[model samples]
Target: MTDAITLRESTPADIAFLQTLYPAAFPDEDLLPLVRSLLELPDVLSLLALARGVPAGHAVFTPGTVGGHAAPVALLGPVAVLPRHQCQGIGSTLIRGGRTRLEAAGTARLLVLGDPAYYGRHGFAATSDIRPPYDLPREWAPAWQSLSLGGDDAPMNGTLRVPGPWCNPALWA
Candidate 1:
């Protein structure tokens, strides 16, 4: 915790705010459709980081399964913070808060396709031996990371299956 950023579960009303926030944060990529679709997935955790009552950052964790295990797991991604709020600790706060909640709710591990450096600071590290069901671009091998979230520390050694909306081939590339 950062004292200024307030983290909370996003309400339906906050979707519009997130829609605007995503574009502002990622001007080149259109993440709005994915955000809208992920919101409908069961057991998805969508957290909002509000600075002074306005949305400053957002993160989402959704159900995912490893090919051979029943243990709970999640996929985290598309974490966004408004350009004006970037590097202000709002993104870190949202991630920490979401990780805590997910661990408490029994999530075993989390996987992400993101910058290794940024996610590594939050306890994520590159995983080998495990792979996504679809071929993630070869260059992204270093970016494919996983973290033990109150679960076994054993290497996650299987292909991953994420929610339908997240199955887009464009994302894997």
Candidate 2:
């Protein structure tokens, strides 16, 4: 753990590590199927963080479209870090790294359904301009958030059109 953390785009070889890491990071959730599907997509960006050459954390960004936005849009989800790696800034590192890559690629907005406090610290704010694919619970409203990736200031308004894997209603809740 003394080695400086390094970031890299995830590869197929990293799937085994992700399978083990996801469950450990989210014991109550099964995110493997979604992760696997996202990896096979044509435009998804999956990032990996390594500490001392071992996988420390992973983050996935799936491309989507906000009806009115001419630029690119993406969703960040299921960001996972091993329990032992928690609070070491590995998760934050993965997030910022992914955003940096996406922004450079002309991605306009990044969406996430996660903890407001944690994501808020990373610049995600509750956005009324765009809506989630499925209706969110009243109390869970704040969990749906977005960050502008230096794309454009023009407001976008539309439901996020995600890939087939993320169409599951269960995941929306």
Candidate 3:
């Protein structure tokens, strides 16, 4: 069996490691700077996953609005697993921790942009009513998805108000 993995609130000390981790985990995406900015946002929730006392993964969740809806929502992104620890369920563990924290915070829904198949496994699906503020390319529409955690209310149509790091157009493309 694998060693028990622990999730912890990220501290300032973890910043340096995350500065290195994001780039290494996403070599082609140049997402390190964006991840760094997100980490510093006061309204964001930053978490780190440790396996056998080693930093194995990280996830960033930031508060965002559904424009006109009073519905509470959060954005999930830039989740990363150390290269050596990938495919070992470390990423999955990180996500579970995020979900629990979000639920505890009473966040009704979560949004992400990625391969639907992957996020779908975590109970996220494509949402038509709520869309990102920016225009996603026609073909990539399916990548913009959301997951309802504890709400069965009617859908709302509105734009997402994200933080500065997420304002960059590159993220939606």
Candidate 4:
């Protein structure tokens, strides 16, 4: 049987765990630097999931804004789980935990650029109402999705304003 998974806010102390986690989770991509920089940014929420006291997965949420939405907004990304921990609900636990914290903090919406099939299971739906920081490829447009966090449901037809590190067009592509 698998060990119980525990969720907690990530601290600088977890960087070493992440150094190895991200590389293994995303072998072909170089997302380590981005993940490291995000952890040091103010207003960014990071979560760590541990299995039997060992780091098993992680998720990061960063504040962002849609041009017209008045309430707070956030972006969910760079989430990863160690290869061995792949389908044990750790990723879902991290996401739900993050959503709970953000909603408690008055966040209006949470956006993510990921597999539609996966995020859809978590209540995320494709959204054309709010645009991402940059134009996504036509095929990947469906990957841009959002979930309303019980704040304001008013239409937000504007581009997302992300932080400096997320401004890189290369990352958006």
Candidate 5:
């Protein structure tokens, strides 16, 4: 593991890097097309982690609506770090940096389908306080964690809706 890594907002030039890194993290059949579609959404947030100038991981955040309210929530997904870079904090940095940027932009909450053990370090928790649009499997639901930028009272519960092709069931599956 390198002593230092760089985190940045993915630029148009970084699409290739994302394309390369995502598959390494998630070998799902629907991921590539989902990536392509997510790139076109106006509310999408994409980030890249670079180690020694080489892309090591990628993370994507998409705006979601809950319970018919326009809650400024983000759905984090596909946070992928190269197998070699798994435990070196690259994933954590990418997630933290992305959340920081979103919070800076006035986003209120973020939702993620990932390990609570991993995300909990960043103030994420799985509370029955919020509900997603679709029913997530029990195992997956336990991993659903939320982080609030505006404090605990911020509207945290609602159905999550992603724009465009991201709404497809296959991608969420």
Candidate 6:
């Protein structure tokens, strides 16, 4: 039987685990620093998923704007699950929990560059109109999906910019 998974706001104690988990997903040195900067941003939302008191996965979301609307949208990314924990629904649990928290806080949208098959199960759909920043790969582009909590009319088209080091050409590329 699987142990219960718990989702919680990331604390300083979780930083070490995050550092370790990040490289597993994004091996690029530039990406790490950029991720670090995003985690430190005031508007960023960081979450950790644990199973039986051990870290299983992590997720980060940053504030963004879409289609000229300044709503509190999130750039979901760098979510990583421990290799041993894959297929156990730990990642999905974290995502659902995080979305619930963000929705409760009045967030209007959640955006991500990930697998359509995976994120789609969580209500994420690629926007026919929206586009991510120029630095992301085309494959990643196709994976750009959004979940609108503010009804179907929510704006999806617009530049999605990460709040910190992600803006740096060196880091973004």
Q: Where does candidate 1 have its weakest 10-residue lDDT segment?
A: 128-137
Candidate 6 residues lying further than 4 Å off, grouped into runs, are 1-3, 25-31, 135-140, 150-152, 169-173
Candidate 5: misplaced stretches above 4 Å? 1-3, 28-30, 68-71
For each candidate, the alpha-carbon lDDT, in order, equals 0.86, 0.89, 0.84, 0.91, 0.77, 0.75
For candidate 1, the TM-score is 0.95
The deviation in Å at residue 54 for candidate 1 is: 2.1
- State the displacement of the C-alpha of residue 25, model 4, in Å, after optimal TM-score superposition: 0.5
lDDT for model 4: 0.91
Instruction: Give the poorly placed runs of model 1, Cα more than 4 Å off.
Output: none
Q: Quick one: best TM-score, which candidate?
A: 4
Writing each residue's lDDT as its tens digit, candidate 1 over 17-79 gives 987998898989899899989998888999999887777999999888887888888888889
Question: How well is each residue in 1-173 modelled by candidate 5, as lDDT tens digits?
Answer: 54588887778887777777767777664477777777788868888898877788888898876666655778887788887778888988888888888888777788887788888998889866666655777778778788887553565555677688756665554
Clashing pairs in 2: none
Model 5 C-alpha RMSD vs. true structure (Å) is 2.3
The lowest-lDDT stretch of 10 consecutive residues in candidate 2 is 1-10
lDDT of 4 at 32: 90
Candidates in order, TM-scores: namely 0.95, 0.95, 0.93, 0.96, 0.86, 0.84
Tens-digit lDDT track of model 6 for 1-173: 24588888888788788778767755654345666777788977788888888888888877776667667777787678877787888888878877887888777888887789999999998875666665566556658788987464554567775566556555333
Instruction: Give the range of the ten consecutive residues with the poorest summed lDDT in model 3.
Output: 148-157
- Compute the lDDT of residue 21 as modeled in candidate 3: 86
Full ranking by TM-score: 4, 2, 1, 3, 5, 6
* Model 2 spans with C-alpha error above 4 angstroms: 1-3
